[model samples]
Target: MDKKINIYKDVEALSEGFTSLLKEELSKREIVNVSLSGGSTPKALFNYWVANCKESIDWNRIAFFWGDERCVRPTDEMSNFGMTKSLLFDKIPTIDKKKIHRIHGENESKEEVQWYTSIMDKYLPKENGLPVFDIMMLGMGDDGHTVSIFPHQIDLWNAEADCVTAQHPETGMERISLTGRLVNNSRNIVFLVTGKNKAEKVKQIIEEREKFADIYPAAKVNPVNGKLFWMLDEGAASLL
Candidate 1:
């Protein structure tokens, strides 16, 4: 469960650094498959990647996926697909629409989960029956939750299911998330957290937590046979 943590001062710097790393990874892999998390920080990074890395990427070789999303229409403001489209897809002309796979959380949570599972099963590298993603970009909430796995719901951490449709306790909306095992199977995992509010949880996950639990979903992020990196803004890294 060895992992590497990276700290930054702000979202802007994090975005720049991440975009640069993404471009480099793309150059090396030729085909880059990544699962992205939803949040303001990632939205900002999407915009930055669109503007800075669009031409550098081999658009057709990149596949886009989300780590989790609210069960809302693609047009909804809370929709992760909508945010990525608005901030990135619409701006990047080289990318083929087919390469950007958006989970239909709006229409079918279970169906989408199964469909995405099939997609991952078809595309990702497999070891011991699990698809190992190339890179999974995640975000941590102020409460220490990453993806839709919230505190008090550690059951999600141990979920043997590849994906699950759950409800956000506060929002009461449905969500589809890849199980911890699937995420930890990735070749690389990077968490992008911003704002001062997240500093405490970042510190707790990096310093205080041992095993991944519902109370600290981010603590569960350990890339299988790879590295886990955290890209944090100053406010989020303040406590670290």
Candidate 2:
């Protein structure tokens, strides 16, 4: 796996960087499959894309998916699909509804996983018996977790399924998340992380890889036959 690190002065800079990267990726092919993450970091980036790139890009050629989502109604504020729709999707009238593949967060978690896995199999590009996303946008939690995979629930990192049910380590709220193997199969995996509170964990994951690499779930995001990019703001990259 090839890895790259990009540190920005702040969230605004990070958002701009992500937008530029997204545009570049979109221009590379006629159609692109992108998996988005839910978090404040990506929310800002989504807003940037909506305000700037919505009119410029060919939305019809892009397919949207989520890396993970809370088990709540799509109308709920905590819903990843809800946030993305409001911040990005809903604003773009040209985007195709058929291209938006969202997990039924309000449904039973296990069933939702199976349903989403089938959707991925049908829509996403397949390679080596796994769906290969063109781009997978991710965010890191303060606890070194990413895409609903927590430190305590490391088994999900190597799950054979393309998608699986996950639970928050503390709250135990159910979630549907793409398995780590599936995420690693993507063409590009970009992690957008911010906040000073995550500095130490980010440092341990990026700098002290040999030591904490096996412990932090975020550190396990090594894309197979793809590129991995870590886009961090000054706060998150402080300890690095």
Q: Rate the local accuracy (lDDT) of all candidates.
A: 0.80, 0.88
Reference-based TM-score, model 2: 0.96
Query: How does each model score on TM-score?
Result: 0.93, 0.96
Report the lDDT tens digits of candidate 2 across residue range 111-152. 889999999999887876789999999999888889989888
Please count the clashing residue pairs in each candidate, in the order shown: 4, 0
Q: Which stretches of candidate 1 lie over 4 Å from their true place?
A: 211-214
Write model 1 residue lDDT over 91-162, tens digit each, in one string.
888887887877887767878888978888887778767987678888887777787887767588669888
What is the Cα-based lDDT of residue 146 in candidate 1? Answer: 80
Candidate 1, 227: how far from true, in Å? 0.6
- So what's the TM-score on candidate 1? 0.93
Worst 10 residues of 2 by lDDT: 205-214
Return the clash pairs for model 2, or none.
Answer: none
